[model samples]
Target: MQIVEDDIRVDELCTRREYARWLVRLNSLLERNPKHRIVPTISLSGSLAVAFDDISVDDPDFVYIQALAEAGIIPSKLSSTSLFSVTPEDGSFYFNPDRYLSRKDMINWRAQLEYAILPGTKEQMSRIRADYMDVKDISSDTSPEFFADMLTGEKSIIRKVFGQSRRFQPNKPSTKAQAAVTLTSGRMAEAVQHELLRMEAESSSRQAAAEEIKSELLVRGDIKNFWNEKLLVERNRGVEVQKLYIATLQDLDKEKNLQAQNLTENMKEKAAMDCQRHLILTLREEIEETSERLASERATYVAEQCNIQELRKAALMDQEGILDSKSILEAEVEALRILRTWVEDEAKKSQARAKVLEEVGRRWKWDNQA
Candidate 1:
């Protein structure tokens, strides 16, 4: 961390990087432990505001307080700063007495400033420096030379201080362009702002004239009666309007009821339509079943007709065969007659055998029997 030896002394200049780093560090330290913007003599705790305005700087109480503060006896909050430093979400920075003060007391701030003594006595100036630099009283020989001795002595470490380097090609190239744009934008808005201001001025004047007229009217006692009468008229009109509103609501209710009735009728019609549709569907199904039955019956009838035709054809073929062969038909008839005659002959033989009491019956040789 040590940059130089204790025994050695150099007159070489420090780099800008070192300076910048130290500067940034100092800024960070300040941010971490913020310094007071001002140290006030007055403090407010809740509703209670404690002020040192009653005591003058020459007073024993004021001197005693400063002594105690120097001795670290009095608290910094009570001795120097306010109870609170309100900023951002911290409320107002300046002291505003408007919260507790009345309209009559708002302008009366001279009382608080009655004992407002400017601290630290000023040394009489022998001559004024052209650059407004005050004559610094450097008394101690052992005291560190803050500026003059360090810059002038042969043991001076800083030989030169340089300004910012040429930034022809800057780190942020768009910065210049953006700054130009911002400036141009402001210039562009100037005319509009001027016009707006002129319009606002005219409006303000008109408002002021209206306010003046209103203020003048405040002197008239009759205006109160006029407003009261107007108010009464407005209230009566309001009552009539309310009655009309109620009548409108009643009409709306009636309309709703009518709509409801219509809706009910529509629902009934819809229900009837649905029932009719269902019945139509049922009838369609029945018709389809009947049609299917009829189709089956027709097929059966056609099938039966086909079978009857086949049977009739068979009958006609047999008749045709009989017509074609008439001799064969006569032969079959004669054979059937012979078979009947044989049965009759058997009956006669049985009777004859019965008459003889032991006669044997004769069988025909039709069975190939001998």
Candidate 2:
């Protein structure tokens, strides 16, 4: 169990005083909770190389150092020469255990804590074994798996402390303030991780909601298109109906025109038939009159022919009578001629006789005179 020391300035330099307080608190917690005895043990040197004359078991700083080493946070190989080494020329070597912890040391310690907290699975052990091989200058007696458990796991506590790179400059010391901050950061990593997970869950929910909304919109659009198509079909039907209505009207008009034409033709035919009837009646009457006239003329011609025959007979009778009269007149003329001839003959005879008498009388007178 890691101790969360109250009154410790986690953002300031971690002084020896703060380390002592933290250690004391850790011991108290361990005493109170016997079940938290799972803290890993660290290998410590059997003896210190430099003999510090002033150092004793009751020394708070020395005790705190020992406590950290036991908890595997600090290595037992902490160089004590700097704390207890005497100057070559002077005997005035002051004891100052208030040295601030280093950033590197704190990171190392944090890595240890993280490794201890990891579950000891077979895969974890194998991975740690592999990881430890990559670490330079590993101790000869250190088990790779055990060393891995004291170093780091997948969640590198070192990275959270140092930012970005997890390079452990093991020898590089840390400021007391930086060490305090590193410790506090390790404790806070869990909360931050949980918050990130929560945010991701919210984002996923939002994405799901957006997809649902898009599907709904698509459905609505399809419905709208369906309605529009129906409307278009209805509109086309109306246009077709109008076309049919107009065609019906035009057909009716054509029928009416045809009927009127038929009526006019019938009337013309009736008029023609009436005129023909009148002409036939007139011709019939004329033919009757002509037939009657021909009959009358035939009768007149027959009578005239009879009269002409009678006239011809009368002329023949006249001619015969005239011929008879001429014959009678010629007979009379012949008779007259004969009578004149007789008369002339008688007259000539008488004149001859008288002459003879006159001749004889002259003779007689001559005789008397003689």
Candidate 3:
């Protein structure tokens, strides 16, 4: 008997590791015996390890065994005796391998045996042993094949074998098409539901993406419109400045024509009386006025031009500012869209998780009822 340490905590008695060790040992023993090949598999019931730890006993014990005779591990005839019987003295069952072996001349024939240990104190082991031995003879060969033909059988080992075989084994996945069909039928509803959920999630993601694109387009259009409006205002101001400049040049031209007419008329009236002096004086006055007017008009035009230049520069700055704003807005919109999408995705994931949890709960309930 190899002792394996217990690791998993259940009750105070046994651990998962100890249980695993015993299972391994039992499986190995069953595999060695051809006679016991009728036995399908072995399984342990209840908290065997926990029970063992609670026991203060020092002796060995047999707890329970479920023998599967259909697997050809245990002999069909001897399967009934497979049900465990406890011994009170040592809390162990005694096996007389020689009685079962017909050929006494055979040497070193080992009986393949496997047992589980149950918990009990040293003092309790003796009492349990006595109780077990008093009930029935577990070692008795109840098979009729080796007995007289006229003898009536008192007990059927086959029935006991079947009864003890009512243990659980993990079901293996089916490879055959028929078994696969059966599994598909059983899980069809869940598979359909899962696929539907996946499609719905994909659709929602697409819808969110479309909405984000729309939002970006709207913001870009607004920024573009604002920038264009500012450009239009600056263009209109430039037109006004050009019109004012043209009007000033037309007024200066009219003043020059009026002064030229006045000088020619004065020179004709002073003929032969030294009219040259009068004509020169008139021309000088006219020239002085024209110069003064030209100077004033130039000053006004320069001031207007400076103002227009400043306005143009301001418009340019405004255009740049609008562009900057547009860029910032674009970035912000993109970020908002991304964040919104992420939030929606997270929400969907959470919903999916909840749905899965609900489905698991329903399945668990159905299995329990079954």
Candidate 4:
């Protein structure tokens, strides 16, 4: 069946009247062609199908007609703007023409078709069969009678076939406001899930860093303590040497004085006294050497102590810095953990709300239709 030239150009935007006219024309055409055996089928690939009840002036219904044309169920051609299909040997239908189009456009159209067919119930199916039987015997398939019968039959049959295929679940029937709420809630839950995962990762990283810092600080402290102890031992050794030298000098002076007094009575004793003086001078030299050595040793000990103290101070400062850093990191980790918890809670609430909204929408739709 050929579409009349006048009916060829449907309005770019679909209106209720325009839709009715297109349906009528299409039904007439199908009825005249026995090979086509076209029957109206619900589809959800047009703008009108997506937003059926709330369709704006710009929305168009995306529909498919079931036909035995070429031994397969295929969509009917409506206009140049209507989407076309790609034939696959696997017998699966595809909207290949719309592959390049925006997803929103595709989804809206598909939804519109779904909404249109959802209203048809079982009672409408019986009427469609009766109508088809009335026109089954017409020999001249192109007659006005054939066209009328096809339109009536096809419309009834298409309208009566309700429910979606198991594969294509309809959006929950709800007010636009309710649908919006459900979408927002779902998104919020998804965002929260992502945030929680991020927080968990961050917390783990912070703990690892803190442990590394603490270990480094402990090593530094141990080295500082070792150096400080070494300095103290060296300083004590210097003090002991100084005391021993002083006691030896005092003993040598007493022995020299006693020898001088005894030798004062004779010339030989005088020579002996001179020798004793030389010995006393040698003892003084020894004492001076010992004092100088002790002073040098004491200076070395002080330098060592100074160096050790400086090292200790630096190590302590580093330890303090590490401790501070650890504290800050711990606090940040805690904050993130808290935030993660809050996000998870919010996600749960949002998910629950979305479920409730969807259930309510389904109930309301059923009641309204009833």
Candidate closest to the true structure, highest TM-score: 2
TM-score for each candidate, following the candidate numbering: 0.29, 0.29, 0.24, 0.24
Query: lDDT tens digits, residues 131-199, model 3?
Result: 111224223332222121111122222111112333212121111222212212212325445656877
Between the candidate structures 2 and 3, which one is better when assessed by lDDT? 2
Which run of 10 residues does model 3 get worst, by summed lDDT?
102-111
Best-to-worst lDDT order: 2, 4, 3, 1
Off by over 4 Å in 4: 1-280, 361-370
Q: How much lDDT does each candidate structure score?
A: 0.41, 0.58, 0.43, 0.45
Per-residue lDDT of 359 in model 3 = 100
Model 2 off-target regions past 4 Å?
1-54, 69-100, 108-134, 137-154, 185-370
Ranking by TM-score: 2, 1, 3, 4
| 10 residues in a row with least lDDT, candidate 4 | 65-74
- Can you write out model 2's per-residue Cα lDDT over 282-362, one digit (the tens) per residue? 999999999999999999999999999999899989999999999999999999999999999999999999999999999
